[model samples]
Target: MKDEKLLAILRLQKSKAIGDILAKKLIVNVGDVEQIFKEKSAILQNINGIGNHGLKHLFDEKNLKAAEQELNYIKNNNIKYSYFLEDDYPINLQNCIDSPILMFKDGNINFKNDKIISIVGTRNMSSYGRDFCTKIIEDLVQYNPIIVSGFAYGVDICAHKVAIKNNLQTIAVLAHGFEQIYPKVHKKYINQVNENGGFLTEFWSEEQPLRENFLKRNRIVAGISKATIIIESAEKGGSLVTADIANSYNRDVFAVPGRTTDIYSKGCNNLIKNNRATLLTSSEDIVKMLNWDIKESPKKAIQKQLFVDLNENEQKIYDLLSEKGQQLLDVISLECNIPIYQLSSILLQMEMKGITKPLPGKLFELM
Candidate 1:
């Protein structure tokens, strides 16, 4: 974290045309972040993905001035940050190809042995989603997992609050800089969040929370956790984008299944229906799926019934799964001769009955 190297990183981050992917390429090709700025434009362009459009802004005098100002703010305010190459960078985010090269963090954030899970969903929270958030955090208290979220309204703030209530570390990944809080209303929770965990962002202090900034921040939220859970969402929302990003990173995704007619639940139901996420009924689904068996003495006891009654369609699906071990939704539909439209409803009911559970990649099996 030499002053000179930090400035170069800030300058590279200011480039509009050079994204995280291209920036990392330049860093790797040049062998150092500082070397990218010192190397001639012609030599830098020789690297793959470096082009005239990008190089134009790369060395722009305006960008240099902006970086200088940002650097001054970091130094004067004693702001904390993590470089992607450094050991302190989030371990989960390091594996992602498009993770930010640098991120500013605040609060008593600790990365010691802890399970991190991001719980995100719509800003318009319903009673069901709210209750689930509270219940899940309460259930997960035994694991001492760090709850990660957007720190926005609804499910985001709900997750953070429950984490704080349960005495668990919670990280709020902001879309804007640490200089300001978005939605303005959530400012009340800032101090509490810092006390429990902290705030994280890749944006510079002067940057505003724009539409695209949120989309970009979604990756960090998705990447910086062992799993991403969607409590509820509309047919479309930022949480779904986070789920997609987590899937791309080969991370586990869990979505709370809601009734088919619930408007806000459509996105989560679709995610589970399509097999992009597992059907999350309760904390046991997470414990079982993630194999969170650390510290044997402290493990939560999950009692599952030995068997549950299954009706005709449920029995058919159950019989097929019991026979085939685990089967894709499409394969089960085809093999069991159950039409997908009807089968979807049947499977959902079966899930509620604790007869079967959905898995990532559309697979289903007896629970």
Candidate 2:
């Protein structure tokens, strides 16, 4: 992106009152991010949700100075970033409604592989949690998933280390800016994480790791992946928050159930009991639930028996499955343009006809 355009985005991001959703609205309505600045107040005020209070911050002189300083730091450091609307932005996160408009990147992070999962848990991880975290990542090495974590103590660091040990890409989502590392002790693993995967954050260079920032950071951890795995969590902790955020995003969340008496297990058990997350026992659950075990083969023409009757929607679904191989329920619904409520019944009907079979994780495939 051009300096001017990036600067405009930074300025918008720095605006105190205008958040990502409203910023997006302003961008879409104005037709250009930079033009939002050049447009007259009267014209911008005409846009819905753009009131006087928002306008005051949108053009705040202090924001421009801050944005410029940040921009210069970005240029000087040769920092990498992804604009929410850009092609480089993570696709999974892009689908999230509250994802950051601009995310900074470090190290050699790669999003080419869509097989990404975030693993998080209590910082006071127990032996059971540690073993499960290691075993799960090691088992998942075959699929070479990108392991994402907060780069904090306990489960987060363990996930990163295990991913590194398995030669899998592991990304650390930071609560603070690039200038400082939280828990400062984790600095030793920084080089390894960078070489193996990288770090990601939405904060600027000088941002600190505030308490609220950690809460906000959980959303990124949840939003950036296809699924979230909670190896262990206390009855109340950040991992639970991440799981909630993941659930809100309609992403799959898996919690490893443990003995109810165990402090760390309480959160996972509650998540399972409350139906907030799937009960994960082993890596097999993840593989099956994510349909990772299903590999796409060469597509061939549909071969249905002539005697079998099919409706329009069923035919559309059959064709899609035949072309794309196994697909998630949501993807099928989207591609077939069928409502989820209707799609479920249609899929059941197809299943009864021995045309399609359901897989774990709401995936469906032709039998």
Candidate 3:
């Protein structure tokens, strides 16, 4: 990014009222981020949610100074960043509705390989959690999947260490800024993590790891991967929050079932029981559930699975699209005798199953 564009984004990010979600909307609404600054308040206020209150914060002079200071720190430290619109941004995280607009990274971080999955659990992991986590990462080494986790203690550090030992890429998504690392003792593992993969954060250079930041940070952990696996979690904990966010994004979620008596196992147990997560036993489960067994071609694999997995209703809908070609959502609903209300959810399910894909203008087609 140019100096002007970077500064504008920093300033917008520092603004109080405008968050990541609204910042994206403003940029899209105004045609560009820099244009947001050049456009008059009258023009900006015309945007759906932009009002006098929002405009005041959008152009706040105090935030400009803060942004400039932060930008200076970034330049002085030779920090690297990826804008949401840029090609270098993490592809999975890009699909999230509320992903950070800008992310700072360090170390030899390569996102070219798409086999990224997050392993997250409670800070107070037990012996069962430790053994399962280690064995699973070792088992998954051959698949060359990138392991993602928070750099906290217990399960987080265990995942990072095992991934490094297995010679696999492991990304640590931090809750605090680059200047600080929580649990201070975990600092020793930082070099190992960078050597294997690296650190990624949405926070600025000097931000603290406040309580609320961890909750906010959970979203990135959940959204940055193809799936999130919970080795162990208490009934109420951060890992559970990550699982919830993953489900909301319609991503795959896996929880290791354990003895119901274990306190740390409560969350994972409930997750499996409530149908919020699939039961996970070994590395094979992950590979099978995620369809990592690559065969001939993606299209051919999906086609072959259709006959084996599609139900009567799904088959009718799939057959119509296969025969008639791409059609509108309403048209498919009418032709297949499925109501519009029911068709929407069916389409979403088909999308998750890799059977059909949705296109612009409410169009649908076989994958």
Q: What is the lDDT, from 0 to 100, of the residue 248 in candidate 1? A: 86
lDDT score for candidate 2 against the true structure? 0.90
Candidate 1 has what TM-score?
0.80
Q: Please identify which of the two predictions, 2 or 3, would achieve the higher lDDT against the true structure.
A: 2
lDDT of 1 by residue, 1-367 (tens): 7999999999999998998878877776676778888899889888777889999989899999999999999999999999976668786676566788899999989987548999999999999999999999899888889999999999999999999988899999989987889989999998999999999999999779999999999999998998999999999899999999999877899999999999999999999999999999999989888889644574342233344555677777877777445565655664565756778888889889777898875667777
RMSD of each: 14.8, 7.1, 8.6
Q: Residue 276 of candidate 1: its Cα lDDT?
A: 99
lDDT of 3 by residue, 40-119 (tens): 99888876677788899989899889999999999999999999766688867766657888899998899988788999
| Candidate 2 TM-score, C-alpha based | 0.82
TM-score of each predicted structure versus truth? 0.80, 0.82, 0.83
The CA root-mean-square deviation of candidate 2, after full C-alpha superposition on the true structure, stands at 7.1
lDDT per model vs. reference: 0.86, 0.90, 0.86
Model 3 misplaced regions, further than 4 Å: 296-367
Candidate 3 matches the true fold with a TM-score of 0.83
Q: Tell me the lDDT of model 2 at 167.
A: 91
Global Cα lDDT for candidate 3: 0.86
Clashing pairs in 1: none
Give per-residue CA lDDT, model 2, range 257-332, as digits (tens): 9997899899999999999999999999999999999987966655766426999999989987775566666556
